[model samples]
Each structure stands twice: as C-alpha cells, then as structure tokens.
Target: MTEMVRDNPALARFELGDGDALAVAHYRIADGAMIFTHTEVPRRLRGRGIATRLIAGALDSARARGLRIVPLCSFVVDYLERHPEADDRAD
Candidate 1:
C-alpha cells in the first residue's frame, strides 16, 4: 500500500502512515537546509520500504521549498547515496 507522508513542522518530523504502523523522519531546518537527524520504523514494519517512503517524502518536501539537505541520519545518507538523482538537493 502507498503511504502518505505528512510534514509536522510543530514536531519537526515527516510522518508516514498512522497508528501502530507509523514511521517518522526527524529533521531540523537551519540556514535553508533540512538536516535529517533520524529515522524510525516500527519493528513490525522493517524491511518493508516504509523508511524509504518516509525519506523520499521528506526529501521531496525539502526540494519543493528549494532547501538543501544535510543527511546526518545514516538511513537518509544511504538513501541519497543510492539515488543519485537526489544529489542536487543535498549539501
């Protein structure tokens, strides 16, 4: 199933899905950059591409705002590494 990721600026995170299946990519904005600090997925949701969706959504939002990315989170770094198309958006 396709999940919808929502940016909760109040919480400084990009959220995906809901309830028990919810996942999040945590970030902080600084100097026109989105610094991705962490990513989390429920144990039951691992290896299901949920984290990938979350990162993609977060990156898309940053790109839409014309902000660069600082991927401090390991997962986000790896995602960017695998997707060269996103390099333009990264710092």
Candidate 2:
C-alpha cells in the first residue's frame, strides 16, 4: 500500500514500502480551478500505480475544496484519460 500526505500548499507527497516514493504534483488555484501544472512519480516507482493514487488524492482534495481540475501534467492527463470518472471535476 501507499501512503499520501498533503505536505503543504501546492504539494502532496506519497510513499510506498520502506522507500520514500514521492509523486510531486504542482498546482495553483485560479478561477475556482485547481490548475495542475505537472506531476512526477520517480522513474523507479513508475508502473506501480503510485502516480494514480497521488492524482486521486489530489482530485479528492480538489473536490473537497469545491474546485475543478485542469490536468496539465502529462502523467495526470494520461491518467484522467483512462479514468473518465475523474474527469467530472476537470475544467
């Protein structure tokens, strides 16, 4: 399992196993939308679904704040493309 924590504004951190796996998604609030700039899951952690979890958590956070999402990150864009349900909150 992976652990996600909102470390601060515009950032969320995720971890898996005994390693410090991190997914860094950049965001900015504008016009009631959470404009996601980019997201990165370390190369070593790729294909493990950590990025998905991280994006999911970020979307959940946006939903909680009544904000829409604009997935600018290629990884996030690809993720949203596959998970249509998450696009409901996208701007």
Residue lDDT tens for model 1, 37-81: 999998888888889988988899999998999988999989989
lDDT, model 1: 0.88
Q: Which stretches of candidate 1 lie over 4 Å from their true place?
A: 89-91
Clashes of each: 0, 0
Inter-residue clash pairs, candidate 1: none
TM-score of each: 0.91, 0.79
Which digits, one per residue and each the tens of the lDDT, describe model 2 over residues 1-91?
6355463673443223317655577778878888877776688878877777778877888888888887777877887889888874453
Pairs with backbone N, CA or C atoms under 3 Å apart (clashes), candidate 2: none
Clashes of 1: 0
> How well does candidate 1 match the true structure in TM-score terms?
0.91
Q: What is the C-alpha RMSD of each candidate to the true structure, in Å?
A: 1.4, 2.7
CA lDDT, every model vs. true structure: 0.88, 0.70
